[model samples]
Target: MTVPSGIYIRKARIQDVRTIHALLMDCSKQGLLLPRSYNQLYSHLRDFFVLAQDQGAILGCCALSITWDDLAEVRSLAVAPECRGQGWGRRLVEACLSDAITLGIFRIFTLTYQAHFFERLGFQVVSKDNLPQKVWADCLHCPKFPDCDEIAMSIEM
Candidate 1:
C-alpha cells in the first residue's frame, strides 16, 4: 500500500510484521540491504517504528536498536520503491531520531550504501574501526561481512 507522507508516525503493530518483512526482503534481494528473518522481526518488534497514515498500511520500516549507554543503530531502513524520491525515507529517519532524543540518546549511526543520501540528512562518514566491537555481532550474520563495503555514517542529535 502506498501511503502519502504528512501523517503521524507511530509504533509498529504485530500485524505489520509480514508486510514489513516483505519490504526488507525486497531491498535485500537487490543487494541494497540485509534480509531479516521473521524470527528476528518478532524478537525486535518494539525496536521498530513504521510509517503509515491513519488507516495503517506500512509504508516503510526502520529500527532503532539501543546499543550501550549513549548510542543507537538505525537498521533496515527500507522505503517502498514507489515511495522513494519523496521525503518518506528522511521522515522515517527523523522519526527515529526524534524518538531517540526523547529517550535521551543523542548518538545515532547507520551502515548503508546510500552514503550521499544519508549525508544530506546530517550523517557523516566515519571509519568502521571506530565503531564498538559489539556492533559487529550483527555483521557476522550478514552474508557480506568483512568483505562487505557498505559505508558507515553517524550523526549527533
Candidate 2:
C-alpha cells in the first residue's frame, strides 16, 4: 500500500530482514516493543510487512502471526523515531489486519504497552486469561512470563 510522501508498505523480503531487525531492536531498547532475535526474524520473515521509502530505507515494520484457527497476534511493531506520528504505524497494522481477513482469520490481538495506540485502532483491552492458548503456547516462554505487564488488546473483524 502506498502512503503519502513517497513511502509504501509491502510484504517483507529476504533483503529486508536485517533492517527489520534493526527497527525492532531500536524499539525494544526504548521499551516500545519486545526484541526479536535474528533466528526468529528469519524464520518468520513472511509474517512481516515493512514500510519503506522510495529510496529503499525501512522506516517501520510489523508482523502478523497466526496463533490458532481464528486468532492471530500482531507483534513486532516498530516505526523509526522520525516517522512515529505520521500514520505509518497505523498503516502497517491495517496491512496486518487486511492480511488476516484475506486468510479467513477474524480475530487479532496484541500484547502491548501502547494500549492507547491500539485503542485508537479499535482494539479493546482484554484479559490475558481470555487468551489461554497464547498464554500456554508463547507467554510461557517470554522472559516476563508470570509478570507480563503488557496490556492485552484485541479486535474482532
Candidate 3:
C-alpha cells in the first residue's frame, strides 16, 4: 500500500516520545496494545520508527527491539485512529522490519491480538514456548501475565 503524500516513516526522535506515548495510551485504552511508560519509551527510543507528516505530526509508531543474537521483537505498533486504513500501520511495521534487516537480525516476532494483520506481512503463528525465556521478563509486568491471549507470530528474513 502506498503511504499518503506528506506522511513518511523514519527513525523516532526524542521529541517524538510524548506523541508516541499518547498514541499508545489511546490504543491501550481500547485494549489494542499495552501502555509504555515514558522512561521505557525514552530508553528504547532508538528502537522505534514513526510515521509523521512533513509538519511533524506523528501519526503512528512501531519498534524493533533486539532480543538475542539473531532475534528481535516487533513491539509497540500503533496508528492514530484518523490515519487508519491508509496503510500507515503497514508502513510503520515495514520500517521496523527494514531496520531489523539492516541491523543483521533475520528473525522477528510479535505478540499481538492482530494476528491476521501480522500474518499478512508473512509472520507465521508460533507457540509462545518456542520463544526464549528472556521474552517472558516483560510478560511479568503485563497485566495478562500467565494468561496472555496475544498470539505469538514470527517471520524469517
Displacement of residue 145 (Cα, Å) in model 1 is: 2.1
Q: Order of candidates by lDDT, top first?
A: 2, 3, 1
lDDT of 3 by residue, 14-77 (tens): 9999999999999999988889999999999999999989999998999998888888999999
List model 2 lDDT by residue over 25-141, tens digit each. 988989998899999999999999999889999999999999999899999999999988989999999999999999999999999989999999999999999898899988899
Candidate 1: the clashing residue pairs are none
Name the lDDT of candidate 2: 0.93
Q: Which residue pairs come into collision in candidate 3?
A: none
Q: Which candidate number maximizes lDDT?
A: 2
- Model 1 vs. true fold: TM: 0.89
Across 39-100, the per-residue lDDT of candidate 1 in tens digits comes to 99999999898877667677788988887689888888998887778788887888889889
Q: Model 1: number of clashes?
A: 0
Query: Which window of ten consecutive residues has the lowest lDDT sum in model 1?
Result: 1-10
Error of 3 at 16 (Å): 0.9
Q: Quote each prediction's TM-score.
A: 0.89, 0.96, 0.94
- Candidate 3, lDDT over the whole model: 0.89
- How many steric clashes between backbone atoms does each model show? 0, 0, 0
Q: Which has the greatest TM-score?
A: 2
By descending TM-score, how would the candidates be arranged?
2, 3, 1
Candidate 2: which pairs clash? none
